[model samples]
Structures are given as structure tokens and as C-alpha cells.
Target: MSIDWDRRHCSRKGHITYAPDEAGLRNRLHASTAVGTVWRCLRCGDFVLGEPHGSGPAELAPLVPRGRALRDLFILRFLAVERVLRGVLVVLAAWAVWKFSNSQDAVHQLFESDLTAFRPVADHFHYDLDHSPVIDSIQKVFDYKKSTLHAAAGLLLLYGLIEFVEGVGLWFAKRWAEYLAVVATAAFLPVEVYELTEKLSWFKIGTLALNILAVLYILIGKRLFGLRGGHAAFEAQCRGASLLEVEVAAGEAGGTQKEPLPVRQRSSTADPA
Candidate 1:
């Protein structure tokens, strides 16, 4: 009778076909028969297979999870710099708002024509001397005078709060955090670009470029922290291999009355005692 390989061991009967491994755990093909297959084990990271006789037969790639050991150090440096930059931005913005609010004389000087003539509207406000067509246009869209400092303060605080939250989430490798960071950073890009065009300064240009880089880094480099297609495939391959092993072991044990197969085991540097 032809030995039914299908009915023979754990490796043959699975939804996904596994290659044979000879150097598996303890190296016994089957407890009774010497027949077996060879494969690499992902768990133990070595050649794995049965001896001359064994029941379970499955092949797998040795798993070696790769990551930069110094990656966290780089990340720590990035956060430290970011915190300092954030503090400076807040301080500058706050000072600008405060300076613009209480300085009536400076406001008048801005509207003064040749340091002498005030516009017709200056008679009404006394400080409209500095008002120009640009200021007039800005006022028409949104007023930000001394009286509205409280409202402006609230808005600035809200903006800073959102940015701070995004930064914290990004540091933790959370998927939702990455998404939030991407959205928040992207939302500011257009406005930043406009500011860059309006005035080409080191500060403005640098801020715009930094924000753009942050957006791209979050969305592309990390795949939004594994919310992408590649991550799904990687996870699937890992889990699929695990499930295959379990099924093969159960199948081989049920099929024959022969003794369990012997397998070879190896020690690795990464393994713990």
C-alpha cells in the first residue's frame, strides 16, 4: 500500500501548503517512521525538522524581528528640540498679541501719513492714524483690537493645545495619534504656505518647511503607525504560520498510533535562559 503522505504527518494536511523541514525540533521524522520534511523555524530562529521518523511535518521561515536598537535615542532628541521650539513660538505669539493690544501710540504711528497726517477716520478713534488699506481690509474680515485680546488668547491656546496633544500621541506609536497628527499638520500647510509667500523670512520659511516634513513623516514613513496595507500582510503571515503549526501537531497525533517524532532544538543568543 502506498504510504498516504496526506494521512502521514502534520505538515501535509493544511489549507496552506508548508514546505518540508528535516532539521526541526529534536529531529525525529515520526516516532515510528524515519520519513519527514525540513524547514526553518520562525520561533527558535534555526533549522528545524524531525528525525528519521515523526508525524508532524511543516516548514516555516525563521523569524528575526529587526529594529534599530538606538531608535529611541533619536526620538528622544527630536522631542526635546520640539518642546523648546514650541515654547518659543508660544512666547513670541503671546508677546505680539500683548504688544499690539495696549500700544495705542504705536497703532497711531502705523496709520500716520508721513508722520503727520491722520486719515478722516482718525478723528473718531484718535489712533486710526496708522490705519492703511491693508489694515482696513483685515478689520473688515476679522477685527483684532485691544478689546478682543481675550478672544484671540482663547483661540491661540486652543491651537497650541491641539498641537501638544498631537505630539504626545505621535511619540507613543498609537495609530489614532498618528492620524490626528497627520490631519492637524496638513490642515495648517496651506496657511503656512500663504504666510511664506507673503513674507520670505527665516522664521516663516523654516516653520512652513518643518510642518510639511512633519505631515509627510507621519503619513508616509510610518504608514500612520501601521494603518496601511503592508502591516496587514505582515501580521497575517505571522499569525498564519502559528495557526498552521497548531493544526499540524493535532493532525499528526490523531492519525497514527506510532510514537511521537523526535525534533532537534537549537540555542540562540537572543533566547533567554
Candidate 2:
């Protein structure tokens, strides 16, 4: 379904109204009615009743994210959530590995005794527990040196920390966070691909694909690394989305708000709804 990004944002954050000092801009933003004054919302471009939330020169107006900017924010936040989840899982895995390293001998003994007890059951079901790939895998972990286990845990913890930081940065839509995400995610692509080459799995492929997409989306969408006219172009695109900026630009171009800001006002005597 198509989403009304502007209205959806206004609904959550409340309407934002600004009174510009410029007469032409101010006239377009608000009007005096019999009941009260209604100012146009910069976020949704809807006339809102009551006083404007703020007043300033048109150039001093706040940059409010509407439309595509909101959508981009949503996408970045979604990636942020994914990064947080992965970070948590990785951290937990690191903890588990560290704990297992500490009690390696006890766990190994327990596994052997338990396997012995289950051997008869396995034979009854014609299952070969002795050479099972999964069993061998668990046994091989027992063979890892304590130092090796500790090193693995440390690496996992470091990775988890990176993911957590990246997630938090993206959640706030910081440009530096976007850069960090691109670099960190792209840096892991080779390792992920190598893992898939070693042991193919749908999960691995999906993760790799997601990482690649995230890198591309952030790198290109954000105009990073000087692509597509770089940061200047990006900032301009975002500025163009502002209702105030649009109107101010129009006025500067000798068109008086360029095109009239879309606004609906009740001409009736009924109090502003």
C-alpha cells in the first residue's frame, strides 16, 4: 500500500508550523480567519489551527524531513534494528564461547557420558551416533585450545561491538554513521563470501545479500565517496523537500513561492477544525 509519509510523520510527531518573517512567505504559510489563525505545517503542508510553533526568517526555518526523507530515515532505522539484533546475538555467542572455554573439560566429559547412555537408543533406531557429522563437530570444538577459544570469543565480542555502534548511529540518521555502516558492512563482504564458499547455506547467502544491499543503498543513496555530485547534491535534495525552502526559492526566482504552497483552508465561519 502507498503510504502518506508526510501525514504519517505529522501524526506521530505532531504538526510543525513556522512563521517566516518574509511577508510573502508568511502569507503563504498562514492566514487569519474569523475564529483564529491557521499556519501551514512544514511537514505535511496542511493548514493547522492555533499559533505557529516557531517564527523566524525563511532561511532560519528548520529542516523538517517529509516525503522521501522520511522514507529514507525509515529504511536506515530498519537497518539499524537488524544491526542491533545481530550484535546482540553475536555478543551472546561470544559469552557462550567464553563460558564453554572455562568449563571445557567438564562439558567434554558430560558429552561423552551422555553419548554413551544414548548409544543403545541410537542403535535401536539404526542411527550411527559415533560418526555423526554433528557429533564430530561438537567433539572437534572440544579439541580447540583454551587460548584459541578465548581468541574466538574476543573476535566475536569486537564484531558485536561494531554492529551495536553502527546500529545506534544509523538509528539517529547521522551522516557519519552512514559512512561507518558502509565501511564496516563492506569490509565484511569478503569474509562472508569466503564462509559461503566453504559451506553454502541459504542463511549465509541471505545475510551476504542483505549486507551488500545495505552497503550499496547507503553508499549511493547517501552520495558517499563523492558519487553523484557528493554531499552537496544530497544536502540540496534534502533541502528541496522542505516546504519553506521550496517557497523561499520560488520567491528568490521571482515567482513568489515559485509555485504556491499547497494549502487547504476553510472559508466558513465555523471555528477552525
Candidate 3:
């Protein structure tokens, strides 16, 4: 009989009151099963004595081992967190641009009005107004056209949206998200490398390394761009040591059982007097 492996809970049997916890069930089954045998249901937590026929016992057919999936999920979550932080930064940048645009007139007025008074304080601090690149840049920003500020804010918002989308998609383990992340991250590598060439810093190096690692992990581990036999090979690997496959192999090696099979019981501890 064909089984819908996607549905984890046993609806007809009503084994569990709530929805079946696949992770919990997997741990229980892994601990219960013998070294060479596969006998527990990852879905419904039922013991499999023989091939499940007419709902006798739900077969164990995990798409991937829980341990490996957990690790992959953890990596995805880390990437998601990074993307989310980037999104927030870009959003804050957009807000900063908006605020600056609104307050530039006041700032310019204040700078012009206080130039005489500020120069004494600047002199006291040994600051050179003629050679301060930071002050020059601030003055240039304050003089920038309104259209340019709007365009900058728009671009920042767009980039923030993209980062937010990538974070949410990766969090859900979507294949499209993996592709988007890899492409977007790789696209920034050239710019990052150029920045590194301009100025060397540990922060820049670390950021570059992280992006490279993320790209590599998505391409190799997720089997993107037909690497390592692509998705088909990945799927096969996931199903290789599955419970259903093992049971089928065992049945093919031998004949069908006529009587009920013996259930392996764990040794119990004795109560002390």
C-alpha cells in the first residue's frame, strides 16, 4: 500500500492527541531501534513488526536523518540572522537619510551662524578646519539636492527589502532563497575586495570571509548549480538509510513472515529492597 509520507500524524488511528512532533518521534525511534534494524515509525511512533498493510503500523520513512537536518537548519538560521541584521542596518540608513534631508537646512544655518564662536572652541581643541575631511563631507551632504537624498533613501529601502526577503525565505529553508542569497552575496564580493584593497582592517577581512563561506556552503551543501549530482543525488542521499528502504531490503533478502515477529524488548531494572 502506498503511504503519504508527508503527513506525519496518524489521522485514522488517533495515536497522538496533538499533532505528531517529528523531531521528538525521530529521537525516540533512533534510540529504540537496534543497530542493524529499523522498526519504529518516525511519524506516529508505532512499532513496525512487518510491512505496513492496511494501517497495521506506520512505516518509518524520514526524508533525511534528523541529526543532519538539524545541523543544516542551524546554519540556515545563522544566515537568516545575518541577513536580518543587514536588513535592519539598511532600514536605519534609509531613516538616517530621511532625517538628514529634513534637518539639513537647520544644520547649515547653525554651522554658518556659529562659525565665529565654534572656531575658538576648534582652536582650543587644536582642530584644523581647513584640513578636516569629515567636516567637509558633512557640509557637502548638507548642501546636497533634495532629489539626491530621496534617491539615496529609495535605494536603501529597496536593498533593505531584498535583505528582509532573503532572511525570511532562508528561515523557511526555501531553495529560491538559497539561490538569491548566493547570487546577492557573490555580487558584493568584488566591491568588498575593492574596499579591502583600499584599506585593510580585520572587520573587512572577517566580513569577506563570512560571505565567501556562505556562498560556498549554499552551493556545495545545498547542491546548487548541479554540483555533487544536484538535487536528485541530494534526495537519494537523504533517502538512502531510511527506515522504509531498510525494511524493504530486509524483506527482499528473506520471505514474508507468516506469524507475528518478535519485538525486541529493553532490559528493565529491578527494584531494590
Candidate 4:
């Protein structure tokens, strides 16, 4: 009987060989290209040597992690979505600013003509026109200088660009993206807090909480800023679960002479049970 190398069985159970998916590989080694022809079990971080040779077993090289990977995936996906959403919102804001600025003259003319026509009627009703908040707000919009509106539009566009870059980088799971997200999110904490102080809402509270969580997750989970021994510890942890080390353990257990076969040969051969 031959072992089913292509089967989707647990590596810890010894029934099948398993390997980490690309995300898992990157997470464990910090560099996927360094190790060749080895994979880690998603469940136990054990290594499985070689690739599935045929249809004899189901393709299971990308082992599904039973624990941490799920959480990590959720967080990464959430941050990516959130950043993208923010980017879109800022873009809309920029557009609105540009449109509003350009149309301000027309708006002012219309408002003045309408208000002049309505003033006699309003006076008949004894309405306090000068004290009306609505009227004051409309007047303020008309008073905005062109240069001020242009500056505002420029700032919004720049903010949108930053958000778009962050979203794209995070979506690709880049390490630098994680750092940028953490910093950018943390920087807004004070503003969010101040906004809450001015006015409280469920939406604002939820956003603040999520931002705080994102920052903590990147800092602690990622071992940033020397937390948990920082980059050195992070690299060590990755190496500990790496495929090369796992292969050595697998070799000892199976009592088989382990050697990396050429890619062509490995793809063509099936292991005997």
C-alpha cells in the first residue's frame, strides 16, 4: 500500500502530509521563498514534505489553521475593507467640496433673490430673520472664500490618497502596511475622542473601539515596537514553525531518507504506503 500524499488528512494524525497555504507560509517564515518543497500543518504547525503527486488523494497542501489563522484572516480582511471604505468616503468629500465651491456663486445669487422675495412675507409673520439658525448657516456657505474652498478640496484629496494606499497595501498583507495602518489609526484616536466628547453616538463609539483594537492587534500580535521581543522574537517564532524544521521531524518519524527532489520529479512521483 502507498501513503496518500495528496489526501486532505491531518498531519498530526500521520494519515496524510499537509502544507501551509501562502498566507500561512508567509506568517510562519516571514519569507516564503527561502524554504523549498515544505509546508506546515494549519492545525499543529507540523511540516509536511513534498507536494501531492496525483488525484489519488485530495489536494491538501494548504492546510486550514484550526485556530489563530482564522482570527488573523478576519482582522486583516476587516482592516482592508475599513481602509478602503474610508478612502471612498474622503473621495466623495473631496468631490462635494469641489462642486460646492464652484457652485457657490450661483447658490448665493439664488438664495439672495429668494430671500428678498420672502422677506416681506416673513416680516408679515413677524419672524426673527436675523436670529434664524438655518438662514445663518446658508449665509456662512455663501461667505466662504474661493481660496479656502480650494485648500479644503486639496486636503481631502490628499487624505483620500493616503487611505487608498493603506487599503491596497493591507489587502496584500504587506508587513509595512500593518505598521502604516497602526500609526495612521492611532493618530486619529485623539480626534475621535474629542468628537465623542462633543457628541456621543453609537457609530462614533464603535469606530473608536475598532481603531483602538486595530492598533493593539498590530502592536502586540505583530510584535511591533519591541513588544514580545519585537522583530527578533517574531522571526524566531516564525522559524520555529517553518517547513524546513518540520521536515526534519517528519523524516525522523517516517524513518525515510529525506531529500528534496527536483520540482519535476516531485510533481511526477507518488509515495508508496
The 10-residue segment with the lowest total lDDT in model 4? 264-273
The candidate maximizing lDDT is 2
The weakest ten consecutive residues by lDDT in model 1 span 264-273
Candidate 2: which stretches are off by over 4 Å? Answer: 253-273
The residue pairs in collision within model 2 are 250-258
lDDT of 3 by residue, 1-273 (tens): 744432322343322211112333333343333534333553334555443232222232223233344346558879999999999999999999988788889878898778757888999999997678877877788778988998999999998999999999888777789899999999999999999998899999999999999999989998888999986666555454344444444554576422222222211100000
How should the candidates be ordered by TM-score, best one leading? Answer: 2, 3, 4, 1
Ranking by lDDT: 2, 3, 4, 1
- Quantify all predictions' global Cα lDDT against the true fold: 0.47, 0.84, 0.64, 0.63
Task: Please give, for residues 132-230, the per-residue lDDT of candidate 1 as tens digits.
Answer: 676667444334566687566556666766656655654544446557767876887898888877878998888777777766765665444555554
Off by over 4 Å in 1: 1-84, 91-147, 225-273
Position 259, candidate 1: lDDT: 30
- Better model by lDDT: candidate 2 vs candidate 4: 2
Report the number of the highest-TM-score candidate: 2
Give the alpha carbon lDDT tens digit for every residue of 1-273 in model 4: 744322323432343334333332233422233455554443444455555221211122332322343345446767888899999999999989999899989888998899989999999999978779889987997788988998999999988888898888776666678788888889889999999998899999999999999899878987887899986775555433434445444554677544432122121002111
Candidate 1 deviation (Cα RMSD): 15.3
TM-score, per-candidate, Cα-based = 0.43, 0.88, 0.69, 0.64
**Collision pairs in model 3:** none
Clashes of each: 39, 1, 0, 4
| lDDT of predicted model 1 | 0.47
